[model samples]
Target: MAMTSLPSLPLLPLLLFAIAANVALGATIVKTLPGFEGELPFTLETGYVSVDDSELFYYFIESQSNPKEDPIMLWYSGGPGCSAFNGLIFEIGPLAFNITDYEGGVPSLQYYPYSWSKSTSILFVDAPVGTGFSYSKTQAGWYTSDTKSAWQTYQFLRKWLIEHPQYLKLQLFIGVDSYSGISGSIVVQNIVEGNEAGVVPRLNLKGYILGCPRIDATINDNSKLIFSHRIGLVSDDIYEAAKKYCNGSYDDVTTSEPKCYEAIKVYDRLIKDINKYDTLEPKCTWASPNQEEDMSRRALEETSSDDFILSPPKIPDMWCHNFNYAMSYWWANDRSVQEALGVRLGIVDNWERCNKSLQYTLDVSSVLDYHKNLSKMGLQVLVYNGDHDLTIPCTGTQKWVKALNLTIVNDWRPWIVDGQIAGYTIKYSESGYRLTYASVLGAGHSPQEYKRRVCYEMFNRFIHYYPI
Candidate 1:
């Protein structure tokens, strides 16, 4: 029932920094989380790292595994716009929102047993200037591209390390999911380049971790047809016709391919019935017209206005699948939660799970080359995809990895959890660099959320440099 609150810090105006440079180094130690019981078991530090005119926010959790010697991972959630908190509460963080008990009112919070923090320290960061509680002091700082964003994130980590020098010796890894796979590699490249250039307070860089990374739009887009056919969503005739008419390249469709277009139309109509993220996950029944205006604050104010349906779970076990996300909208937006997080008052008017306001520019087309460069650098890499995910099909990731042509250290084999096959894995090596490719069987876009226990088993082994 007891909680600790960060002291109120006045908002820094546009020119406020001219008065104090250390003002940007704002940080607060959280002893208790909003819906959590008792004191936090792990050290929770919420703070900002000033980068040029942008102030990036981050949540730091000390390792439950072995803080002294265990590795620390810097996480960037995908979406190119989704907040790192999504990665925290929904996937790898220590606590998850208890959306299952909600008939109405606040969503409760509970400790998650399968958090990656159990194996290593984790830093959930809000990057690219306009994500989560991160904000830009200057107008020009608000707009960013892939390359520019990586630079900013790199600088943010460097400064954060400089402030927390005790963590300088811990092995570091850049981790992310979804679209971040594109930028995550670039961020790692930036760190690798910085370390090579002899940057001060050097990082003990190890490797990177990716979850259903969206590296190439064209590659992933084309893989869907293949994925759909392989998963039995489309019949053999439909698959063959698409391959025959489209010439196996579905990345870009020609206006002349009428039969290809017809086949795609049929595919779209059929696939619409299933949840695109995971074919097995049930589709949300959209809120009815009469209940449209009668929605929760999370639904009305913070839930993304994207076309996807935002409904409470119909089944008990699936209650928190996406509904727990609604709690984020409510919790983060609450003035009390903001104060607990040490918000800069008026500096952040509101927080979106994924900031829809970012003027993000996706300039870097593909990170395949970035991965290629890292592959030669002798770093350890882990790339895992949910086999059921349609967003960035495993086939697309396989497409790029096969292109790398690394020697197979371990042939593809079924990975077991509790003595039962959970998914599949293959190991590749070249010039001391080792890469592991894993398929999270039957899971969705974010396997960490869909199958936490199995993912934790896989993560524990990977972080410890053991076989999964």
Candidate 2:
């Protein structure tokens, strides 16, 4: 098949069936990996869901406890471009790179005790079109916008479920780390609509989970200034000046009044030395001048390859977090690792954690309306933020959640784990809709990367309908 053009709407289902009729459902049951020793304890399945001319790759791990009854969550890493391996290895998955012991050639992997998959089956997908192992047969297929990406993902899920009918009855929840929330919300809403429209296999749509998500680009970026001031990164004098001159909006100071522009320049200088992702971490020296400029913008308006700084510095202890990201490059690029994972030969060259170079357009500025629509549907939601993350500050999350105007059911209180405060949380409800909001104490962007155990505890409680 040429796959020269995308399948038309009328012919998409037939195309899906045609692809599924072939053996194996385009999936591979990965028994062993290059760095991990022995057979994997849980079922690890990797596959490509053919969505028209695009091959969306995914890694599905069965629940460690009981896949038969537990909820199934479909997760994708943000950057709209970051590889799903980021979620699989760094954040919520069972395997993690042993960065501390790395003398490095195909970094060693160790089992993470706090993986969310311990309780729920998780499907981690490389989305949009050109992320990770996912690829497009035609140049046109590689191009995607927020609306198109969401639609493609919805199609991917339906086709995937069709191939694995055992999971058809499982309650489905969408989980997104960072930026994917825009599309994730759209995907959830799409799932609901598809079910109501009597779309095949009727997805048991539940709700969604968003971690330090980018909701409104302007609002999120502007919140960074407030977050920085609140966290003591900006001096009171400077913050006050900026607040007064910038008129409470620091996102586009360049075109603002002269005083406002000057105030913002000072504010930016104050924060220039700090690692905005996690204010507690040291600034990365490995980032190029261009990457630093990109970081300075604090905008999530467009996907860029610079989203993740790939190279690890020689001195690991200085910036251990970014150093850890480098392990994925080392591991994924290895011939043995690719062979073990059943990666198609030569489809992708030099795997990137986030391939922002793909032709992508950020069409949706804010998904707040989508959230409002979902709120009326009687679904549940869990929204979390790392208290110290300036990238998409907790303050911004609070502002938007408050906009929903759901009655506060459970007043704000400290949520505990091991008898110590893990974070603060509040619950809101209206009609049948319920939303839980949390802030992970002292963590940064993507709480799971910094507080895996705490995040797992929070997720465990939320998934089981227990209060957090």
Candidate 3:
């Protein structure tokens, strides 16, 4: 295949200014955008599943890609309450709609300036119930939780595969942020173990990929401390003070630590008062003079706050304040429209509520014992993390993987691509798969959005050329 070259630009002052403006605005340009123009159309087959007398809405995205050698990747967002379709419309898929103009009849699809459809079929599912367009009307509390939803999602995938024989050989489960680490593991484990026992027919069974996955809840809890320590958010002395208040308990420490609470209170007050502050989407960008003034206002606000709050607040503070986290809130708040389907959100919600009747098969024991159980079933596991993400810091992930005590076949070292610090890589050959630690430069939680080229390369390495 011939490589497409980037468009050449003349070395002019205006061009330089435009480049500088983009850089200043922190806008990322994806280099390898696909050639297919306009909205990548799809046919949605809507259905309902009866769960506890409630009808739940569920639908799948059938990619309009030719040759279709690229497998179907089931994408889920985090929040356990978030929608997978949001991931489809905003992040990776071919076309995204602007929901800001919903009242206006002008319906337009914004082509992904960069898309991943060239190499894979994408399926964005609204899982459990009460998330996105999925909801439970009769069984109000049926689909409100996480574990039960995992089971329903697994069954849905199985049935979906059977119905769509064309995609049976090309199904792969993939997720990122929170669900990628949690529910994603459940889906992969189900396929692997079921295939081994001869109870469930194995589909294509390609390996899974998690971008900044939130796997272990316990590990994620501790990441707060690690991030606080790495960045100068809280001094070592302040952390020690907060730790004493926590009474050595990691659970709910944020509630116990007065000093930590004070820190957060101070930070929040500062954040609130920062000039040019936008509550919905707070970007870390302002003119230098305005930034200084904002910083001063923040300091004053922190100083004025009283120090006697119950627990320290843990605001979402990170060095890189990208839009990934902010986008989640915006997407979740949109309870009226379906970006992927180009229809009212009401239709989809009904289907999700019906599917609320499904239940989870695996428990905490199964999740904790995932590595051992899945390996025995001949399934390969890949756990990956981007190093720079303070949200799901790489250090916490390292600690969790090390505690797993899986035999290490490949030693830990930096995985470099094109002479850049792409990330670190590790492998456990005895376990029949490789574990990669990719460090995406200038990336926060969602590396795919921030570092697309490197992320694509890593995906190609793992999915296309495994066992290397």
Candidate 4:
């Protein structure tokens, strides 16, 4: 891998301006990290790609298998504000925090065996100019919306590919989880349009993969009632009352008719304490009042850390699934950890896992139109969800997929792993486009966090064009 010069392409003017502006744009081959031992087993490159006044950070990991020929995936986490660590460390990346051994100081690091990078390269990005180590040079850059984030991601990918031309010929795929589904669709559509317009360094855009996707706000908001009833969280009578009174509109129950409002009020009270991300998981209370206040503002369910506690309780009192999220907060904030990852000092004051204070606007309410257009482009797609996820219910995903009206290539059936039923799946196709939908049985919001091994197997098969 050379850090020599940009290829003689149409990117000269932008490249010249980037060089003159003293932009932080270079990749560091991080042989070691603060918590990991000795040297990394895999090739780890950390760097920043300049997008206007925003310097978006990314961690690029080569595949453990055939790196030269394997597919490359650009992964984005949800929250419209959550860090990409939500994808890298927690979901599918190889390195993860050693949560059980943590007592104080920097959290220890351990390798995750079922990382998606085992079969494909992944660029886990801290995007939209305020998440993770990514920061904006100007105050205006701090303000971003759904459309702006999507275009910026396209800009970052173009600039990144110009720097590392080796991956330019490999198949490129956009992989997103949770709320990123909105922007991820836009990014893919943008790439397709760029290629059509003869853009420089044309991306090898094959398709995209989405997990527990948040497609339409109204659909996702309304499906919670169905999910709750199916999972036995709400009684049949209560569910029926809300369904009849609400009359299919469930986004804001308070603003509806009196009977509808009352029905939703009772519905809310029944499941108020349940973790929306995973109904089976206990809702851990946030440690501080400020953190609680922060959580309250995320009414749109844009965040992926709905079940996290600011301060992790004693592991002995009761084990928590979200303690790993807390451990990451302490680990990322450490100075040594920052230095190890080549983070520019003084640019960011605090490193939050999900910074709700960002000046973000939800401009794009629904991206089903993008999907409809992409379906005509003849691209391969995989849309999956966790059966237990309520935040972005699988039922909502099913409704949108059904709306596409693609031919059923494969009927609904159970997919197996280790001779056991992992989940159910169905396949759809229109023209040359293929979309396969699956559910990770009993998994939560982000299925990889709840069922790592099962997800890795499913991903490996999908990327290789094998049956899942």
Scored by lDDT, model 1 comes in at: 0.78
Q: What TM-score should be assigned to candidate 1?
A: 0.88
State the lDDT of candidate 2 residue by residue for 1-468, as single tens digits. Answer: 111233455775675566567527457889999889899888999988888789999999999998999999999988767889989998999999886677758899988889999999999999987888998888678778788888888888887887776787888999997888899888998888777766666789888899999888777878888888888888999989988888888876675389999988888888888877788987763211221133222111223345445334456445546677767777888989888887887888677776646567778889998888888988889999999887789999998899888999999999999999999999999999999999999898789989999999999999999999
Deviating ranges (above 4 Å) for candidate 4: 1-25, 286-313
**Overall lDDT per candidate, in order of appearance:** 0.78, 0.82, 0.49, 0.82
What is the RMSD of candidate 3? 16.1
Cα-based lDDT at residue 299, candidate 3:
10
RMSD of 4: 4.9
Q: Which lDDT tens digits does candidate 4 get at residues 413-443? A: 9999999999999999999999999999989
- lDDT of each residue in 14-36, candidate 1, tens digit only: 22333234533468888986777
Error of 2 at 429 (Å): 0.6
How close is each model in CA RMSD to the real structure?
7.7, 4.9, 16.1, 4.9
Per-model tally of clashing residue pairs: 0, 0, 16, 0
For candidate 1, give the lDDT of residue 93. 85
Better of 2 and 3 by TM-score: 2
Point out the worst 10-residue segment of candidate 4 by lDDT.
287-296
Q: What is the lDDT of residue 423 in candidate 1?
A: 98
